[model samples]
Target chain A: MQREHEPNEHAHHGPDKPTYNLVFVALTVLMLLSVGTAYIELPDILHYGILLTLMSVKVGLVVAYYMHLKYDNPLFTWVFILPVLMGLAVVLSLQGLAGY
Target chain B: MNAAHTSVHGAEHGHGHSISNEQHNHMLKFGWWLYIASEVMIFSSLIAVFMLAKRLYPAEEEHLVLPLVAFNTFLLLTSSWMVVRGLVSIQRGDQVGLQRALMITVILGSIFLGIQIYEYNEFTHHGVTLTSSMYGSAFYIMTGFHGFHVFIGVLWALWAFFKALNGHYTAENNIGIELFGLYWHFVDVVWVVLFTLIYVM
Candidate 1:
């Protein structure tokens, strides 16, 4: 029983389950790194830097893989990313203006 | 969704007289992502507010239960993965698999909420009310809003699970779960940032 669909019913297929497993492992490891480094004595700049970097990587993985943006329409990337950048810009500008 | 059938013309989008199912699904996806995009603004604003408040308040250090919150984070991350698993199941036309995965996700999410409520109780006992200080107020507002989203996610997941139970989706027409998956994943992504800013940093 083949289900009937118009041509091009599915434009793309996302990562398979194994890829998801790999991503899960990577995310978990990244999180552990973030947690482990939180307790270490380090310069304020470097400590915050490391944590922010790790957090960014984790967010990228979740958005790209788990959310299937990598396989979805490119327009989706733009739609989702543009606002994120705007939000970042606002935060940065506020920080600069506030002198904190 | 392996059943064979003839093509019927037209779409519910109302832009044109007819449209393939694929077009309809794409429209749905576009609409949903647009909504998610709007949500990012509100959430990012909340994050910014908290970060700024943290700097201004300069309050005495309050020790939160790191281990407990960390465990809660693990639950949320795992539930996010579970949501994807359910989507994969539906894509493969395994309705039962999707149902079970959604159930697991729901349970994990519920547990996360329970732990958050319990932590709030503990904090309240320690005199950390919303009016305590800017730091406490920002913390409660930001995290409470996220908890509200998680609660909504749980409810949506349950609705999706029931939809699957009714065989409303098929291998080739599972935009329903797929869309839900995207929302759930976005929720998880928000938590990822929240964990870093609110807890770790």
Candidate 2:
């Protein structure tokens, strides 16, 4: 003797999953904040400092989440970041040799 | 066929299997990084030359336009976000979303290019040409090179969008999406550093 019907228990994947929309929203906020701040004048070369800091934060977000490097092996992240550090070092050395 | 020849062919296919698509994709990504390293060297030299020349001729800063470059930077930053959204859409298996994001990205990229052309126009309107002064030469060379790269990236995004419309990518097969995303982000990153170096500082 069969009844009318029964709901499929596993129709959907799961009830507990994180939404990435919040991450996008946060990134958008940071991007806008940085752009707005760029309009303000800073003392001396500190403008580069502020811009670099904000750019790093923005790049960090993109690399970690958007690039999926967060879940990737630490070694892979090292490969991507090592070039950045090296590039900066090269620039610093070149600037030093060229004087101010 | 001879047994020796058959074994040779079998070993060749076996070696091919060992490399795998993932390995090939990683190889291409690493190649991109190496290309960026070369670019870093090139820009470092350009900055060095610019600083040296600026020290010799300190009066050229009067003609530089800051606001237009800032607007161009905003255009690129927004375009970067759109590129990421496209990749994310592909990751989520949303074909329509991917197409929409890519379209927005191309539009933003075009706006950036348009701004660059306007900047060039402004330069010429004010009697600034590549042969005008050392500053003018460096300015056009550095930024013109970057603008050309942006043009290429826009075309790449358009092609990717077309392919996406034709069902080229799926959640499980989205390495192409990631590769283009990486290239797009690299272009954005280079512009970030450039805007700071060339315009702000």
- In candidate 1, the residue pairs with backbone N, CA or C atoms under 3 Å apart (3 or more residues apart, or in different chains) clash, namely A1-B2, A1-B3, A2-B2, A2-B3, A2-B4, A3-B2, A3-B3, B10-B18, B10-B19, B11-B19
Candidate 2 chain A: minimum summed lDDT over ten consecutive residues — where? A9-18
The number of clashing residue pairs in each candidate reads 10, 0
What's model 1's TM-score?
A: 0.89
lDDT of 2 by residue, B1-201 (tens): 112322223565576324545455566766665665566566656655665556555566556677677777777767766766666566667789889978888998999999888878887877778888887787788778778888999999899999999999875577777778767777776776677656655
Q: Model 2 clash pairs?
A: none
Pick the TM-score winner: 1
Winning model by lDDT: 1
What would the per-residue lDDT of candidate 1 be over residues B42-70, giving only the tens digit for each residue?
Answer: 98888887788778874523656777888
TM-score value, chain A, candidate 1 = 0.82
lDDT per residue for candidate 1 within A46-97, as digits (tens), equals: 9999999999999999988888788778899999999999999877776677
lDDT of 2 at A50: 72
